[model samples]
Target: MTEVLETTSGSSPRTRMNKRILTLAATGIGAAGIAFVVAGAIVFGDFGIAPDFSARLAAPSWAHWFGTDQFGHDMFARTVHGLNVSLWVGLIAATLSAFIALGLSVFATTCGRWADMLVSFLVDATMGLPHLVLLILISFALGGGTHAVIVAVATTHWPRLTRVLRAEILQLRHADFIVVSRRLGKSWWYIGRHHFLPHLLPQLLVGLVLLFPHAILHEAGLTFIGFGLEPTKPAIGVLLADSMRYLTAGNWWLGLYPGLSLLLLVLCFDAIGNGLRLLQDPRQAHR
Candidate 1:
């Protein structure tokens, strides 16, 4: 019963040109962001944990570009390491969130009315609460560590993506091919494996990438509030928290550089996600 829309034979010249421009822009931004992360990791990885008591509290100089912390550790190194940690956390958390969304979405669309209703209710309930508060509570309850932060981020971040996926799946459910599959006596699992899963890949990838910034920011926030990674770890939140007391004494570089670094990394992640979204659009690829 579903009506199918046919694609046009070709795009206009202007449209093709526009698509090429967008595709190029997206690819460049994504590649630049990825390169920055990799370069930072390789260059600063070794200096992360080493401390120099003789250089303690030293301001930024040729020897230490980002200055020394209260413990004489290189701020540049710590910031880079912290970024590496945040990226890893974001990657794992986003991947887990995507999987959760995919499962809930598939279940809601393919199962009976009661199952759909259950998923809908759960999504609504989660969205109703304050996201940060829920994340903080979850992290705190789990005893506040790296693992706790990852779990909190993964659990709190899935609702939006789940709703999006559910809508996508519902739309696909009524598609002509899906209707044909059902009439041919194909099982829900078979149809999902052969049709729905393939269709969902693009959305899943975009959603996963978009989740990175949120996960990194939230993890940093939680740590800042004393509900994230341990103080011993050189996390961005830990760095910021440590620098707070020194701010009154006019030691600006301690916090400023790390804060800027974190902001830059988050922006890079966002750009990469946006780029990937554009690249995934077939219409945008032709040009």
Candidate 2:
């Protein structure tokens, strides 16, 4: 009877296989993403800034996988180094954005009604504006560098996460456990540190992970438009911008490989985030 029950349960063989596939897919993608970033770091440290003028505008070959740019720099090396820069910028910006969202959400939920209203108003106002326009304006105003790009992306990307977290915290604030803690003379800080923070961890992590791709893309966009890292910097946006001039001369490899690499990296992050979201759901356990 036990054997029969096991065979008939929701965790069937097919379901288990599917779950395994999903888990493997997620793990593989996440690992690949990390490995790509690590490879970029290694390449940046070892081969960065080693341009050869003799090989200028060379086509892709075994010796130069991604071909050579106008400066005769190895596109493979530059792309990898550029990837490292993009990853660093993305990570820092996403982390800052998440913290900003967390702080605003906490304040809105714990302070007072007026605080909540003010936060809501601010979030709405920020969201109402054109995101790219605001980012460009902020980056331009800040003098168009790495620090400026990071600040612009961080400040502009927090509103959506802030809204979600604020709603979650508002719901949790009136929970019976929270009320009990309040009645027991626990201060808001104490309750928040012990109760609210633990519950917010998953949401915070998800939001941070999801923000990575956006941050990377925006940083690249700003750089491409001459408002991000300087042209001397080996960044993805800079690479793309430089590739534009050679494209009309039929040197497509200059842009093709780097662009594809950026797209692949973004997709990997998206996959990792989606996988995490799915894993967090209990209903997915049997599937």
The TM-score that candidate 1 achieves is: 0.89
What is candidate 1's lDDT per residue for 1-287, written digit by digit as tens?
11222125355667677766765676577568667766887877677587789998889999999999988999988888888788888899989999999999998888888989998898999999999999999999999999999999999889999988888888999999999999999999888789999999999998998898899999999999899989988889999999998989989999999999888877776666666766787755654
Candidate 2 TM-score to native: 0.91
List ranges where model 1 is wrong by over 4 Å.
Answer: 1-23, 283-287
Cα error, residue 192 of model 1, in Å, equals 1.4
Error of 1 at 4 (Å): 34
**Candidate 1 clash total?**
0
Cα shift from native, residue 106, model 2 (Å): 0.6
Residue pairs whose backbone atoms clash in candidate 2: none
Model 1 lDDT at residue 33: 65
